[model samples]
Target: MIVAAWTVCAGTVMPAAADTDPRGYLTKMKAQEMWKVADGTGITVAVIDSGVKDIPGLEGRVLPGMSFMEPPFERPDVSYPPHEDFVGHGTTMTAGIVGDGSAGGPRGLAPGAKVLPIRTSVGTPMAFAVASEAAKGIRYAADNGAKVINLSIGMTQDWPMGKIKPAVEYAQSKGVLIFAAMGNEGEGNNWTNVIAALPGVLGVGAVDEDGQVMPFSSHGPDTDLSAPGGQVLNRCNGNKDWCVGDGGTSYATSLASASAALVWSAHPDWTANQVARVLIQTAGGPVDGAKRSDWVGYGAVRPRKVLLDHEGDPGVPDADPLASPAPAKAPTPSAEQTAAAPRRVESADAESGLSWQWPALGAVVALSLGITVLVKRRRR
Candidate 1:
């Protein structure tokens, strides 16, 4: 089957050349320091992606979750048990959130939390057809004791929102905080995933180890936050080996969701709004001094600022700090705008004077069998 435009947002994965340590993202974000304050205990993060496997580091931490990859959503040629990963995207994402580093696997930012894995047809040809399944996943997550939902998936082209809107609203009403990837369409396409643009969902972008936004991270007003995504270490597809992701907003969303888990675990009584408010308030805002920017939203997520420094006033618990007026239709970028976009970005505000750029990267993996490169359309 062909890969769909809407795929897992883990980006291009390749066998690790070096840097096998999974602590890169944790060290870059300075998450270890915050772990002392909150390791996401008592929080269940729902991972809605290409399913999750009970891997080495995630043993005993994964709760049983339903799979939507049946009949209409599943390709006739492929079949797998519920919660079994096909592309390993969900497993990697789960590792990012709660992996405990057992058996020498990737370590998560929130080692004390549990994961609820929701399987869907992400990274498959049926991704677009299964768009409604994402909504169903959201509803299922909200009803199943999930406090935070992570959507490391998105479609390159806009999809119908009839099912997604209400599902997101339903999850939000249940006090669930949703985080989604801002697809890898990059700046030229400037496409924002419909799911990420929802009223309560926080759309996340990606930043590299150098603290600069990667070229492939999408840009737009809906971009709510940023996190580490470049060259992240992840588990290989359906295997025990480790692979390095070239960078995608998917990892960023996972880290951001984990950040919320840490904050929420520390302040269990705080509502979702209060957690979000603190995250945005403590984030490193744009260097240009703007309150919010399309490139990086409120700024790069810095949960440490809240957990370590005891920063951020958890103002009114019910107030929506990230809410904005209905988003206007985006305008097409002119020749000059496209030509001026930069390859690497250090600022998220519009006035930063950096242009946008898009560069596609491919994934190559060397499994026990052999080496193979995969080029597929996938999640945001």
Candidate 2:
């Protein structure tokens, strides 16, 4: 049973200032320059989250996907459309990947791509059910022509092995790349992310405009790369459009998924392994020049290096860069270790019904200070 209390850290808002075009994240990644080459055309990113609303920015872009929140999978009373968002979290994530900015929403980094909405609960209380649905969602996306799957949701607890692992392997076998959030536990909770830790899945962490990793972003060997998740502008629920999603790995994962869409669209013939390899090779490594680190993994994702500079070499088509050597069978976790494991670190979904505000300068300073100490300790 889950022992830790469920928690969602309050984020400091940084509004989409009029000057920050296409949102701060796109600007940081030099997305405009890359857009001149490819805008995620001919790509479909499956967003498995709360749900998606067919907002104006997403006009004619969102496909009618399936929902797992009701009936056979969930309570019959909780039914809703795949196009309807439950908490606006999924809509924000969807906008991050494919919004066109027609309704004053921040334009998505990959505006030319399409979104397949797989509606499911990402709230804290339904951990087991969510995991089952998430695994199913991954397989569904793989079979239904999605080139990439975005799971902006994560859980602290691990479900049974066969559920999530086999689904991920199936998706990888079908050449679909899954980008999952590394969670928002930070240093305090520091839970191991279940889906993100799986083999062949790219576990994404969050970074800010200054390129420092966000304090709320979970860190570990599973962290494959970082992306701009701070001061990011996007449309919230129907009522509150244009709220900043700052310091959550959910948005970071979405942006990473969009980045994959960009790379894949540019080279339609490339396999999933090639796309995955090129992304890692082009990523900006750790400041100390290390090949990899637990904090930001290979470092912040810099797709511009591949798209604009034509830098990355798409390696062997069948070779998986994220794959690890098969592990020897291990002993089961001790009772003490099992009891010590954190249980309900919340999903990395952005806050709903947030009022617009300017960037919190003080919070930014705190983040920097926190990272400084964490880095020193991590090095040791």
Candidate 3:
């Protein structure tokens, strides 16, 4: 039985037992569901958060990533890079999304997937840094070959999602599926968070094992899907030995990313929209018509539906998901806007040609070694 009055996000799961740890749960779940075909074997997930460390369990699994904070904290997990997970929040997100247990840690929903760890935010104390730096990291991740993006951070800016929006747009054009977390103020429903509100983002919500929406989880038209959240479970404070009580839409977003990986891995040719639509269309419901509810969006995502039904049609590759034809007259970027952007920030997908593969990324991760890397001065 779940705890009442406790509100958490959906897609969150309980930690594993002593012998059957998170890694074991992942293995069992994958085996039980025959998810190896969609275990995200060769895909790359860009985890945008406080950044990810290449833990021993995930050795040779990580590629180079950029940071937005100021110096002393801008690099990826180098020898001296930020070793002690500053908040320890990002690591939890990483493990939940892509952990393929080699150690005693928990296995991720898409254990076979590789992760691109990028830092975009610090906390409420550094909102500005988070916003600006997240924008930079967004562009940097897209510039490389991140086919799927997972961002658990929220923004305070109210301006139309700005730089991150453009980067997401370009990524979509290049066939990347992006997932973001809705704000964690659903009880009050504040309107400041932009991470989940941006168009083209798979904004996720938090639900429990019983599928009740967490009171603290944010709700809006933006939250298109729900995942395990309230009174949730995962590596407690990065200690796989004891799972911690979890909440918030951040973790749910990561799971949504993992789900995208599963779908994408199954149908590599589908456009990002088709992958997203399959998840939404096949989601578990208390749903009614075409319109979705504000609390749970289309409904709780049951990836098992896709794993079983298996009749998804993602439309043509050239067809834009949002637009009918991607109007030719769409506003082009200004000199300043384009100048501030990093090289390949808009996705040179055709040029990059980095097709994701579990064991094959060794060469791409090497080639992407010296590519665009932006380290922010602060955590913002």
lDDT of 1 by residue, 1-380 (tens): 11211222243455666645435767866777888789999999999888887667788788988787645434466555546876777888898888887664668888889999988776554555456777898899999999999988764434346777778889988999999888676745665566777776788887765456666677776787878777776666554666765547888898899999999999999999888878877776666555666767777777877788788877776667665231121112211111123364445543544333322112211125431212212111
TM-score, structure 3 vs. true? 0.71
Give the alpha carbon lDDT tens digit for every residue of 8-33 in model 2. 23344445555544365666678889
Model 1 bad stretches (over 4 Å): 1-14, 20-22, 72-80, 237-240, 324-380
Off by over 4 Å in 3: 1-31, 72-84, 101-104, 124-127, 234-242, 287-291, 318-380
The 10-residue segment with the lowest total lDDT in model 3: 356-365
TM-score of each: 0.80, 0.79, 0.71
lDDT of predicted model 3: 0.56
Q: Which ten residues in a row have the lowest lDDT in candidate 2?
A: 371-380
lDDT of 1 at 140: 97
Flag regions of model 2 displaced more than 4 Å.
1-11, 14-22, 71-78, 124-128, 234-239, 324-380
lDDT winner: 1
Itemize residue pairs with steric clashes in candidate 1: 7-378, 7-379, 8-379, 154-380, 183-380, 341-355, 341-356, 342-355
Report the number of clashing residue pairs per model.
8, 0, 31
**The candidate that achieves the highest TM-score relative to the unseen native structure:** 1
